[model samples]
Structures are given as structure tokens and as C-alpha cells.
Target: MGLKIYNTLKREKEDFIPQNPPYVGMYVCGPTVYGNSHLGHARSYTSFDVIYRYLKYCGYKVRYVQNITDVGHLVGDADEGEDKISRQAALEKQEPVEIAYKYELSYFEDMRKLNILPPDISCRATGHIIEIISHVQALIEKGYAYVTDKGNVYFEVKKFASYGKLSGRNLDDTKSGERIDIATDKKAPEDFALWKSADGGHLMKWPSPWGDGYPGWHIECSVMSRKYIGDTLDIHGGGMDNIFPHHECEIAQSEALTEKPFVRYFIHNNMLTVNGSKMGKSLGNFIVLKDLFKKMNPMVLRFYILQSHYRSVLDFSDESMTAAGVGFERLRNSIFALKDVKIAENDDLTAYPELDALKKEFLDAMNDDFNTPIAISVLYEILKHSNNELNKADRDTAKLEAVKRMIFTFTEDILGFNWNMADNTDSGEENNREDKLIEFLIEIRKQYRTEKNFAMSDKIRDTLKDIGITLKDAPQGTTYTIS
Candidate 1:
């Protein structure tokens, strides 16, 4: 079967055929870079990373573009309030760009730890001010945008009849539910800003056509995506929280100017929740990626996310992470066992029908809108069968190797798991020796603990820590991880 994707634009799972064959252009909404990246950021990026990987695996030359909002993301999701970076800069007593660059680097570092591939183009809003100004000019010339006396420009949402099509709310209803703020001088309450007038106090103002101001939050993605990729995107992805107002305004302005579809496939990942509320900085319940990494393996967190469908809301808790860690260990152990099986010259033709069946099931699950949960189950099935075969009196070494290759293809290749990088890089014999020595030391430490020699056990841990090995004591037992 061909690939199918859940397009938020169409509101259904549709077959994914690229606008240009052998090439796909994807643009995902990136972070604001005003603060540290949290779990919500991880879910959105990881979800799109899988899509980018899968597209490339299917032979589409994918050019993925994710932008950084260094400026112009206002507070309260409105045309008012200080820019997020400006707000953070005032708190830190630093320049707005300084805060943006700091968090931007930190965000990339955390993403690298999670094994997410970098985008082909990491556009920044501030860097694209010229293009954004030109885009606003085109919108105004097309009569889709208008400027107020204060030099602030707003998109004419009434001029675009399909303003609320993406969010499924008509102008009448949107206006009825809209909360008018005294800060905006928009012609309509539902209309959004294209450009904002900045005062002397604003730290991040640029020379735009509308005076010293910055692009609006929604305009940056529309302008930057077109400048980097194209006017019509093959895939545009973000969290579901961005559907209304943000993406809604993007569609209004982009389509109003181009008179074409802004995005063909609109993919949205559901939010990650903690204690039944969204895990976000606004809620003060967010877990930063760097802090989470110090507690557990980053791949463990990735595996926990893969356990649920991207469209489904995932609840975060320590218990869920522990379960995911256990599952990840099981997967790694199975792959390790397969690789350990010795191979001799084999003339015997082993019929491993299970291997082919497992591949089919895995692909089928993935092709159905990237169903990673079901696909991961197929990995366990392959592992279970491989373990049973390896334990037999006459093991088919060729079959074992084939199973290992399949596991690598699914985990490392498609799922973006850096298994080999995370595992020992030494040769087989050297790794075996190191493993045995570590196990021996751990066993001796256990013996010391059993004898109530707390000082000796502590000494063992402290000595290992000094040598770049950190030991964590948990209910399961004490385990050492090499730093």
C-alpha cells in the first residue's frame, strides 16, 4: 500500500502524493526561542522528524524547513503584549537577540540529544525581515492587507472569504467568541496583524515598510516558508494548539496573496499533557529536555513518545517513563542477542516466513499515517522470534543476521533511533571484555552492600564517578552509565 497521511486541511487520512514527483517540500513551525525547550516542543518536532525520515525513506528528496521565531511572537496569542524575546530579555537584562541566540543553541542541543535530524533550512524571523516586508507589500498591493494611522498593518480577514476554513469557524462565529483587546486597532476583531508599530522602548525593532517594527507572529512562517521552500507547501506541521488564529491567519494572508492553496497537507500533533493539563511554560508544568535527559536516557523518552499515536494526547508521568525505559532495554537486549550469535558457512536454506510477515506488518502500520505504536509491536515480534531461534540447538545464523538487519532498518533507519551511537563503539571482543569487567565490578559492589558495608559501596561508586562512570541506584538495583 502507498503512504497515507492525516492532513489537517482535509480532515482525513489521504494518500500522500508529492506535488513534484521525487521531491517533497515540508515546513514545520519551529520554536519561539524565547525560553528553554520543553516536552511540548519535543513532541511536535519528533513527530515531524518521523515524517521527514519516512518521506526520504520512500525516495522523495525531502527539503525540510523549520523556522526560528527570534522576534515577534507576542504574549497572549494576540497583536498586543511585548515580544516574547523582549519580555525574556528584560527579565535577564540582556539584548533580545542574545536571549534568542542562547535559547536557540540550547534548543538545538536538546534536539541533538533526542536524535532529531536538523532541518535543511533553519530560517529566522529577524533575518528574513526584508523578505517579510516585501511579502507584506505584495499583500497590500493585492488589497488583502491595510495599514492603520499608527503604521500597524492588519490582514483583511473579511476580504478573504475562506479566512476560517482551516479552523472550521466562520467569521460570524469567530467574531462572536472573539475577545477584543484595547491594544489592537484592527478593522475586525478576527483580523490579525501583518506588521506592528514599535515604540522607542521596543528592543527588537527593524526598518520595515511600515516604519520601525517587526513582522507579526503568523506572518513570519508564511513569509519564511515561501522564501525558503515555496508558496505552496507540500506539508506544513505544528502542534494542534496552532490551528486557530496562528495557522488560520497564515492561510488567510498566504492564500489571499497567491490565490492558491497555502499548504497541501496540514499535519498537527496532539499536545503532551501532564496531570491532565497541557505541559507548557504558561502552565508552569513543563519539563525541560535537558533536565529530563539527566534523569533517563534520551532514547527512553523518544520511545515513550513513539508508544502513542502522534495524534493522540500522551500523558507524562514517572511511571510511564519507567515502563518505556524497560521496553527500550528489552529491544536493545534482543538486538544484542541476535548480533552475538556466531555464524558459520551455511548451505541449509532456512525458510523464515515470519521475517517477511513482520516486515509487511511493520510497513503497513507505518504507511497508515505513520502508526509507530503498531510498528514497534512488530519489532518486538521480530525480537521474540529471533530470541527463540537463537536459543535452539541448531541456530540458523543467517536467519539471525537477517533479523538483526530488519531490526536496525526499523529502529535506527526509520524511527530515527541512534542505536549504534548510543551503544558501545568498540570491536566485538573488546566490548565483551569491557562488559564482563563492568559486570564483575557491579557484582562486587552488590556483595559489599549485602554485607552492610555502606562505606565500601559508596567508595566504589565515588571511584567510578571520578573515572567518568556514574552509578544510579534504583529499586531494580544499582546500574552504572558511562558519562
Candidate 2:
């Protein structure tokens, strides 16, 4: 079966077909670079990353574009309040540009840790002021937008009969659902800003048709997506929170200007919760990716996120993460063990129908709207069968090699797991030194146990455990697993 995508616009799974065959244009709403990346960022980006990888694996030339909101994203996420980056700048006593660049780097650093491939084009809002001004001008000329004497341009939501079509929120619904106070300059409460006049003290202002101002949060995506990837994108994705106001406004202004469909498929990933509560910095429950990486492998976090469907809410906690880590370790250990198995010079892969069936099931799950949870479950089934086959005395080396290739293809190539990092052996010389030190410590602990010094032996094991290493004592020797 061909790929099927759950289009949020249609509220159903539809066959995935790009506007142009063998070419796909995908745009995902990226983070506003005012703070460090968090669990929510990980879930959203990793979900898109898998989709990107699978598209390429299926022989599509995908041009992935992600935006960096360096300016004009208000604190209220609507037309009111200070820009998020500017607010952060004030609190930190830094320039707004400095704050945006700093956190933008931090965002990419965390993404790299998760093995998420970088987008083909990373556009910044501040860098595209020229195109934004042109877009706002077109909207005004088309009579869908109005400029205020206060130097603010707002989209006339009433002009677009299909203003809330993508979000399924009528103008009445929008007015009721709005959390932020509406700007007085807007003619209607449902109308959104296309461009905002920069205040006298605003640090990130640019010369626009109205005055010295910056583009609104919603307009940047519409302008950047159109500039980088035509007026109509094959796929547009983001977290579910963007359904209203942000994406709703984008649809209004974009279609009003282009007089054409904005996106073919609108895909949205569900939000992530922490300990059953909404994760927020204000709630004091926000989990940063860099902080979480210090506790466990980033790959483990990536693996944990993929255990749930993209359209499902992923409730995260220490317990759930620990369980995921154990499962990931099992799969990693089994796949890596095959490296030691010798491969037969000539072997037929079709000899094993069970392996072939498992592979097919894996593809089927992915084909059905990127169902990663089901796809990952199929990986476990493959692992179980491979273990059984490897246990037989007459196990076929060629079969073991096939298992290795299959696991690697799914886990690393498609799923985007970095095995070297997961195994805690990525750094060659440093890892070797660390391994030798761990062995030395294990040997010393063994001596302590041999002498019956229970206090020293237990202390050593507990110390290692505190540092995310668990010691397992087998009949032959002690082995450790790093979480």
C-alpha cells in the first residue's frame, strides 16, 4: 500500500501524494529561539524527522524547510504582549539578536543529540523582511488586509470567507477561544496582525511600507514557506497547539494573497505532557532536552518518544523513560552482538519467510500514516525471532547477517537512532579510556567482594549506579550497562 497521512485539515488519513511526482515539499513550524529546546520540541521534530527519512527511503526528493522565529513572536502568542525574544533579552540584559542566536544554537545542539537530521533550508524571520513586506503589500492590495495609522497591518478575517476552514473555528469560535486581549488597532477581534509597528525602543525593527516594524508571527511562516517551497506545500506540520490563531491566521493571509491553496496536507503532532500535567516553564515542570540528556542517552529519549503514535499524547515521566531505556537497550545489545557473527559468502535471504514477514509488517506500519509505535513493535518482533534463530547450534550466519542489515536499516536509517551514541561508545579514544577505567574499577570492586568487604563492594556498586551505570554480576564476570 502507498503512504497515508493523517491530514489535520481533513481530519482523516488520506493517501500521501505530492503535487509533483518524486518531489515533496515539507515545511514544519520550528521553535521560537528565545529559550532552550524542551521535550515538546523533541517530540515534534523527531516525528517530522522520521517522516522525512521515510520519504527519502521511498525514493522521493524531499525539500524540507524549517523556520527560526528570531523576532515578532509575542509572549501571548497572539497580537499582544512583548516579543518573546525581546522579553528574554530584557531579563538577561542582552540584545534581542544575541538571545535569538544563543538559543538557536542551543536548539540545534539538542536536535543533534537526538540524531534529528537538519532541514535542507533553515530560514530565519529576521532575514526575510524584504519578502515579508512584499507579502503584506500584496494582502493589502487584494483588500484582505488593512494598515492602521499606528503603523500596524492586520488581516481582515471577514474578507476571507474560509478564514477558519483549516482550524474549523468560525469567527465566533475564534473570539471566544482567544486568550490574549485583542489589539485595539484591529477592526475586528478575530483579525490578526500581518505586520506590527515596532515601538520606539524596539531593538529588532526594520523599515517596512507602513513604518519601521517587524512581521507578525504568523506571516513569517507563510512568507518563508512560499519563498522557499512554492505557494503550495506538499506537507505542512507542527504541534497541535498551532491549530488556531497561528495556523488559522496563516491560512487566511496566505490564501488571500495567493488565491490558491496554501498546503496540500496539514499534519499536526499531539502535545506532550509531563507527569500527567501540562508542561510549562510557569508550572515549574518543564523538562529541557540538554538537562534530560545528562541523565540518559538522548537516543533513549528519541526511542521513548517514538513508542507512542505522533497523533497521540505522550505522557512522559521517569518511570516511562526508564522502561523505554530498558527496551532500547535490549534491541541495541542484540543488534550490536551480530557484529561478531561471521557472514556466509553466499546466502539466500528468501530462505527465512518469518524475517521477510516482519520486515513487511514494519513497512506497513510506516505506510499507515507514520505509525511509529506499531513500527517499533515490529522491530521488537524481529529481535525476538533473531534471538531464537541465533540460539540454535546450526544457526545460519547469513541469516544472522540479514537480521543485522534489517535492524540497522529500520533503527538507524529510518528511525534515526545513532547506535554509537546509544551504546556510549561514540567517542573513540575517550570511550576507550573510559572503558578501561570502568574495567579497572570493576576489577577493584571484584577484589573487595573476594575479601568479603561487603561495605566497600556495595559502596562501589551504588556509586556506579548513581552515575547512571548498573552493574550486573553474572557467573563469569560483572557487566555494566550505561543508561
Candidate 3:
């Protein structure tokens, strides 16, 4: 079956076929790079990372381009507050570009922690000034944009026949709904900016035909995507909140100039809400990911996001994270168990009805739009069977091995979530203070047991079990895990 994708532009699920065979072009709107990445940031990018990984794994060469909006992403999002990186730079008392470099490195590091491979090309808006200027110039020459006396280039939204097609709000309806704060001289209220003549106080202005100004927030993707991919891209993705003037203006400016579809399929992941409200800094509900890592495994955070469909709004909380942590451990343990156990010859298949059924169901769920939550539940079924078999001395070889591969491939490779078991890179990988200390104490407990200090051994074991990690005594040695 062909890959069925939910296109936000079409407002329906449709068959996904690329413009070219054996190669696909994908562009995802990356972080603004003004602040530290949070849990919600991870969910959106990691979600697309799985899609990028799976497409390449399916034998297609994919060029994944994600842009860093260093200069023009306004703090209030649409176009109100200060430049995000610039604002952060003020708080840190550093140059805006310095802030960009710091967080760009930090953002990729966090993504690497989750095992998300870096994109093929990482473009920055500030670096692509020429491309954006040329794009805005083309729009001007084609009669799709107008420049103000103050050197601001705004796209004429009323001139585009299909201005609101992507977001499903007709042009008339959008105009009525918005109390547009259009610069008094603009031709129309909904005419969003393509380039702005930066004021003297602006820290990150560039010289353009319009003046010494920066490109607007929406124009970055419009220019960068065309510079890297083309005017018409195969897949353009971002958070659902970006469907408005951000993406809509991009469509108007790009399509009005190029006379082609700006992006073929529009994909959006829903927002991350907290306490029944959307998570945002404005709402004062934002939690920094680096801060959260102090308390939880970052992999568990990724797993928690994957447990729901990408389109559904995921409400994050301690309770949900704790549940996801337990579930992820079960998956990790099943993978470990599979590596050690050898499969025996199964003479017949009918005996393992529940096991066989699970294998079929897991693939079926994955085949349908990569419904990972359903696929994860299918994994639990196999986890249940694997744990049952592990409890007993006898193991069915074929059934055991098959489920192991099924769980590993789907969960790790396809879903893009895995627990890191080996030594961390060039440093102690597991960063939680509590976890590292507990590991240290467990090592000492192992040594105590080795030295025949039964009294001290029991005390450490009892203490750790009460916290979370259970010390298991086996014939080979002692192993521990967080419950």
C-alpha cells in the first residue's frame, strides 16, 4: 500500500507520492534558536525525524532541510515582541549572533540525545540574506508585493486568489477575524510583511533593496526552502499554530511570484498543552527541557510523545511521564532479553495464536499512517508474551526471535525511540544526579556482596528498592532497574 499522509492543506488523508521517484525533499520549520529547547520542541522535530528516518530506511534518498530562524522570529510569535534571539541576547548581555550559535549547538545536542539524526542541510535565516532579498525582489517585479516609503515590503494578500486555501479560512473570513495592526501606509490590513526596514535599535538588520532591514518572520521559510529545495516542495511541516499569517503569507508571497504550488503537502503536529491549557511562555507554563532532564530520562520524554498520534494534542504531566517511563523500561528489557535468548525450531505455527496475532497487528498499525500509539500497544502485547516466556525456563525459539526483531525494528528504527545502554560519549552519559549517584551506590552494593558483607548489602538493597531501582540477585551477578 502507498504511504497515506495527513495533509493539513487538503484537510484530509491522501496518498503520498513524491514529485520525483526514489528521492524526496522535506522541509521542517526548525527552532527559532533564541532559547533552550523544551519538551514540546522535542516532540515536533522528533516526530518529523521519524518520518525522515523511515523514508530513508524504505530505500528513498531524502534531503531533509530544517532552518534556524535566528533573526526574524518575533517573540510574540506572529509579529509583536522583539527578535527572539536578540531578546535572549539582551538577557544574557551578549551579541544576538552569539546567542544563536549557543542555542543552535545546544538544540542539536538535545536532538542527538534523543537519537534524532541531523538534517541534510541546516540553513539559517540570517545567513541567507541574499536569497531572501532576491525572492522579495522577484515578488515586487511580479506585482505580488509592494514596498512602503519606510522600506517595508509587504505581500498583497488581497491580490492572491487562494490566500487562505492552506488554512481553510477564506480570504474574506480571515480579514474580518483579524484586527490587523497594518502599518498605516500598507495597501491592505492583511498584507503581511516580506521585508522590514529595521529601526536603529534593531541589532540584526541587513542591507536590502527595501533598506537596512531584516526579512519578516514568514519570509524566511519561503526564501530558504526555495533556495534549498524549490518554490514547490514535497513536504512542509511545522506546529499546527503556524497555519495562520506565518504559513499563509509564505504561500501568498511564494506562489504569487513562482506561479506554482508553494508546498504540496502541509503537515502539522498539534500543540503540547499543560493543565488543560496550551504550553507557552506567555501562559507561564513553559518548562525547559534541560531543566526536565534533571528529573527524568530524556528518552522517556520522547517515548511519552510517541505514545499518542501526532495530530492529537498531548497534555504533558508528571503522571503521564511516569507511566511512559515504566512502559519504555519494559521495551528496553524485552530487547535485552531477546539478544541473550536463542530461538528453538517451531514445528508448527497454530499453537502460538496470541503471539502470531500480535505480529500481524503490529505491522498493520504501522502501515496505516505510522500510527505509533497503536503500534506501541501492539508492542506491549509482544512484551507481555516475551515476559511470560522469560519467566519460564523453556522458550520457543522462532516465536521468541520474531517478536524480538519486531519490537526492536518498529520501536527503535521506525518509531525513533531507544534507550541508550552503553557508556555515554566522552563523559558519563546518564546525567540525572539521582540516577548517577544511585548507580554509584549500586556498584558499591555489588562490591559489598562480593566481599560477603551481608549486613551492609541488605541495607543498600533495601534503600535503593524503596527509591525506585530494584536490585536483582542472579547466578551471574547483580542487575538493577528503575520501576
Rank ordering of all candidates by TM-score, starting from the highest = 2, 1, 3
Tell me the tens digit of each residue's lDDT in model 2 across 364-473.
99999999999999998988866887789898887887888898899999999988887772343454567788899899999999999989999999999999889999
User: How far off is residue 185 in model 3, in Å?
Assistant: 2.5
TM-score for each candidate, following the candidate numbering: 0.86, 0.88, 0.83
What is candidate 1's lDDT per residue for 1-483, written digit by digit as tens? Answer: 999999988899999988998889999999999888989888888888888998888889999999999988987777887788999999999999999999999999889878999999998998888888998999999999999988899888888988778889888887885655644567878778889888636778888777888888999999988887787999999999899988999998889888889999999999899978867667888898867765566777788898899999999988887788788888877887776765567633246777888889999999999999999999999898789887899877778877877888889879998876446322334545666787787889999999999999889889988998788888988777777
| Segments of candidate 1 deviating more than 4 angstroms | 180-184, 282-284, 341-351, 421-483
Which is the leading candidate under TM-score?
2
lDDT of each: 0.85, 0.90, 0.80
- Model 2 clash tally, residue pairs: 0
- Give the alpha carbon lDDT tens digit for every residue of 127-217 in model 3: 8889889988988998888998988888888789988888888767766847434466678777777887787478999888777998889
lDDT for residue 222 in candidate 3, whole number 0-100: 86
Model 2 TM-score, all chains together = 0.88
